[model samples]
Target: MTEPARDTIHCARFLPHPPAAVWRALTDPELHARWWAAGDVKPLVGHRFTLDMGSFGSQPCEVTAVEDERLLAYRFAERTLDTTLTWRLEPEGTGTRLFLTHSGFDLDSPMGRQAYEGMGRGWPHVLERLDAALGEAA
Candidate 1:
């Protein structure tokens, strides 16, 4: 018998900011901390980063991939379930199309279900915060 596979969650946004701008928000610790619940990040690939939002348990994560002005991916560990986050940017008419996929979550398991639901509820607000930050920076 094969092991059951984990369900994945995908969230996407079309931002009114350039891909470079979105890329900065995704990669820079200060820029990310302004929106996402992130802590000190080394700002370099293969480096460790931590995220603590005062409520969610502090997560020890790592930057796994980076492509200038296009993509950023990370592995977030130290949680009830381990996962990988991928951010992709495509240049659109005026700004960029930002896509996020948080894969490796088991929607069937209690913890995974909670994580999936909570992130689905909370990330939109976080994305809004990112928009405001981008506007301010513009």
Candidate 2:
């Protein structure tokens, strides 16, 4: 059996907003629900959340850590497949760099491979949506 996809993937994007703005969107349940899923998602440390994407799939995540306007981490305690999620924001001159990573997937399995590809397509669109919100807010 292949090992799980631990810390093996990296996705990054630059959002045109200050770190504080991006951080709010990341850590606030309401703001996150707006762009992500309009459901229960509290981004506080130790809070558990479920990302229900209708019939697509549902992911259960637990907040792991938070550092002011810098980083947020979640462990995917339950999923259609195994994964850990995290978001890191670093302030640039006039904006923030956002990085999202999902780890611990068994890519050799069909389900795992499917999830891997799906996330690859999904994250960029989500980032684009966040970019628009940031742009309009600025």
Candidate 3:
């Protein structure tokens, strides 16, 4: 029998910037669009927004938690996939270590399985884009 894939995607990187800067990149809409999806992301809880996901259309999201420059969590694709994306930041030697956990994927469904696999491949590239965006902000 074949083993099933894990139902979560996790990524982490040490960015050469302060947590505040990284937090801005994650929250500020313009900077966020330059890195990830285009959305009016803010560091406020209980805010609802939508992201332009290219061909996937607008995906609904809701701010679930915020902790200044340390953490941000949200419900992504709330209308459909209902996944939670959490970003954790920690200070590290004058820079910041960023960690991401995209969980709540239902591996039994085809859409969920596909998204899990696709996002697993795509997040690394997105993080690289984040790096470039932060570089431009410098």
Candidate 4:
């Protein structure tokens, strides 16, 4: 029997900042570029943009949902993986708890499996970068 394909990557982190600060890091294109890729990311529904993923080229994206500093969801790499990336932020004492979910990977395909594995390792580093960026800003 073939092994089941993994279809989602979830990561969470607690940052020593308010939700608004964390949200800005997630939405601001310049701040985003510091952590992950460069993109015209905004917390506005129906916005469309592309992220420069270095050697992976540019990935087309569209904002599917937005809830101010609470949540942001977008369709990432629409022409490629067609996955959905969601970010959720919740107030926790003096800081915010940030959660990321990247879903809809078609693990049956070789590309999907490869991406899942690569991103599984890459996402943590990306989050660490985000933390470092926030530290610099703070």
RMSD of each: 3.6, 3.7, 3.1, 3.3
How do the residues 1-138 of candidate 1 rate in per-residue lDDT, one tens digit apiece? 964345666767889988888888877778878887767664468888888857667888888887788877888764667888888899998899888888888777898889878887877777789888898878
Candidate 2 weakest ten by summed lDDT:
34-43
lDDT-better candidate, 2 vs 3: 3
lDDT of 3 by residue, 7-92 (tens): 88999999999999999999999999998889988889999999999999999999999999999999999868999999999999
lDDT of each: 0.79, 0.76, 0.94, 0.92
The C-alpha local distance difference test score for the whole of candidate 3 amounts to 0.94
Task: Tell me how many clashing residue pairs each candidate has.
Answer: 0, 2, 0, 0
lDDT of 1: 0.79
**What TM-score does candidate 3 get on C-alpha atoms?**
0.95
Query: What tens digits encode model 4's per-residue C-alpha lDDT throughout 1-138?
Result: 965336989999999989988999999999999999999998888999999999999999999999999999999999789999999999999999999999999899898889989998989889889989999998
Show the colliding residue pairs in model 1: none
| TM accuracy, model 1 | 0.86
Alpha-carbon error at 31 in model 3, in Å?
0.4
Q: Report the C-alpha displacement of residue 126, candidate 4, in angstroms.
A: 0.7
Q: Which stretches of candidate 3 lie over 4 Å from their true place?
A: 1-5
**What ranking emerges by TM-score with the best candidate at the front?**
3, 4, 1, 2
Reference-based lDDT, residue 42, model 2: 56
The true-versus-predicted C-alpha distance at residue 3 of model 4, in Å, is 16
Model 4 stretches with alpha carbons more than 4 Å out = 1-5
